[model samples]
Target: MTLLWIITALWAVSFSLIGVYISGQVDDTIAVTTRMFLALLIFLPFWRPAPWRKSLRMMATGAVEIGLTYLFLYQSYHYLSVPELLLFTIFTPLYVSLFSDLLARRWPRQFWAPALLAVAGAAVIRWTDLSGDYWIGFAFIQAANACFAFGQVWYRQQSMGNPLPHRARFAWFFLGAFIIAGSAMLLTADWSKLPATPVQQGVLLWLGVVTSGLGYLGWSYGSTKVSAQQLAVMNNMLIPAGILVNVLFWGGHIEQWPRLLLGCACLAAALWLCRKRTPAPSRST
Candidate 1:
């Protein structure tokens, strides 16, 4: 927990920064690859080799989660409005729940309720009219969501069995991401669009070193501390938190107060459900 909540607050500001400073100003591939590269370097000093199997697993998770997820996510902004992008991400909580349950091979009835409620809460705040190309954007976001959900769940489960501390083993994860990200950058990047201004350079540096490096570390470690239900619901918390950040500092506006209030209430209830103890699903199921 606490790590998760803190990371949420940190990430809430990241979207706005990318939207204002990086998008269209920099090539997505370059920006992403640079972040992954810098993030990998941050953890290099603490890097320890896990068992071959565990190392490969973390690498795969990083490729799918950070590499593919960011690629699809950045592509999505091209096809979708900011509101549309936010709306599409409302499905992430559901994906997190589904993947967690399926991977565990058990029906955790208690987890589903809060996850669905969290979805509802997030959708309430972010839902808006779609543009004509929504299908493509939606598909990209869903792919990102699936990758992200599976990665976190896989990491959480594996963390339980791993002997090494989280910090010591995270370098492999970032290295995996860098491999994929760097390849994508090589293939798709526009050299002309690299950071030109001091502001842009500064933004990239902050995003790469702090946002991607420390942020992912906090999230990975924190995911292992919470139940799947809580983790699922927390995925949605970023929506409202991000919106609030945008409105307060970035000249964004809320379209509807009622929707915001209702959504907040639903999110509160979902969080309460996560905190409350419920009967576990029988093993026979």
Candidate 2:
């Protein structure tokens, strides 16, 4: 849980960085592809061969979770403001809880309350007018949200039999992401819009190495440590954290004081409720 909190903060910054530095300046496909490729490279030195079946599953998970999710997310930025994007992702906690229960074949009803509470909290934070293209952007974000939630739950439940350590096997995950994102880049990338400035290159490197590489690794590992219910609620923590980052550093036009405090209170209440409901014993993976 501590690891998750740390990664959540890191990811909050990433949301703003992508919006401010990368989204408009770089082609979405190219950015996604480069990020995944660089992340893959970081783990390549530790890679070891695994069973073909397990490798395939990890790859597919990465493809949908990181690769396809990023595709929709970056595209949505074309129409939505950064705060709108963050607000739209409030639905993700519900998706995460639903998918986790469905995959586990056991409905944990306790999760729904916290998940919904988190949604309400996030909704309170972004209570404002919508853009003309709001629905279109909303649809894209929902697709990304569902994919990401499903992937995390699926990966958490997977069983690896005496396989290499997660770090050693993690390269397969990014390899899968690279395959999808790389293909998309080939199909749609604008050669003309490639990173032209030192800042762009630096941002790309930071995103690839620190954000994508370490962030995903830490997040994936952390997911294994908590209950699905806890994971569901924790997903919303990003909303407030990201909003704070946007407001502070990205010049986001949010009413800064009372609303933010109320939202944080709601999120904290949700997390507290989740902690009270003890999670089931960890499943063998």
Candidate 3:
């Protein structure tokens, strides 16, 4: 759990920093498009997955989870500060929980504590400082999280029978994502203005290959050994990790230490709840 926390925190910080860097270089659409395209290329040699037969449900999730999620997230970076963003980003667990219940035939109570902790932690982080602009981003983040939750459920369902090898499945997922994102770019982009600096190109490459590609690989590798509770705990750490990286490296706003401390406390409480042992369900007589 400790090692997972450290690795997941590092991944989150890398992702946050990449977001900051790319936001400055290219338009959000192009940034997402380019990243997906590059990620596709990187994954291609590894697995060479064929495109899956299109289902309306899968297509809908692809649009919401892959395309729209990135768009809104990129837009939020422009409108909201990092800590403010983190406040909303932390709600991922809540979205995951609610959606998980809706999808599962049985309403499992396993997620309640972690969900509460994540919400409370986020509140502690942003309660006093949150502004109207941040709320807009929060709403967008909620939508993104919902899409992500549903997408995960969909992937699990569809993949269970066909069972594309893990490497192949990832390759296919990125490829599918690129196709949608690329089409959107063709419809919306202004190609006349490409990123001008080497730094911008470098950032784009890192965002595509390292953050998007390698990050998922690292996560999968780490997740195999960690319990669900540990994974939940590791996720909450992304908020502080994002804050610290943004402030130290990218000159992000960091005015209130008390709020940050409170946020950490909230996150710690959430992880503690995860560590508690829930009794196994009893068999019916």
Number of the predicted model whose lDDT against the real structure is largest: 2
lDDT of 1: 0.78
Candidate 2: worst-modelled 10 consecutive residues by lDDT? 276-285
| Residue 192 Cα positional deviation in candidate 3, in Å, after optimal superposition | 5.2
lDDT of each: 0.78, 0.82, 0.62
Residue lDDT tens for model 1, 1-285: 788989999988987788778888889999899889888888899889778988999899899888889888887877765544665566676667667767768554576787678667756764675345656776788799889998888888778758887777778898899999899999989999998999988888898898888998889888877777778778987887887787788887667778867876776677567545343322221
Off-target runs (Cα >4 Å) in candidate 1 are: 107-129, 254-285
Greater lDDT among 1 and 2 belongs to: 2
Comparison by TM-score, 1 against 2, better one: 2
**Clash pairs of candidate 3?**
none
Arrange candidates by lDDT, highest first: which order?
2, 1, 3
On the 0 to 100 scale, the lDDT of residue 265 in model 2 is 74
- Candidates in order, TM-scores: namely 0.82, 0.83, 0.74
Cα lDDT, model 2, residue 85: 85
Candidate 3 accuracy as lDDT:
0.62
Candidate RMSDs in Å, in order, are 4.5, 3.8, 4.9
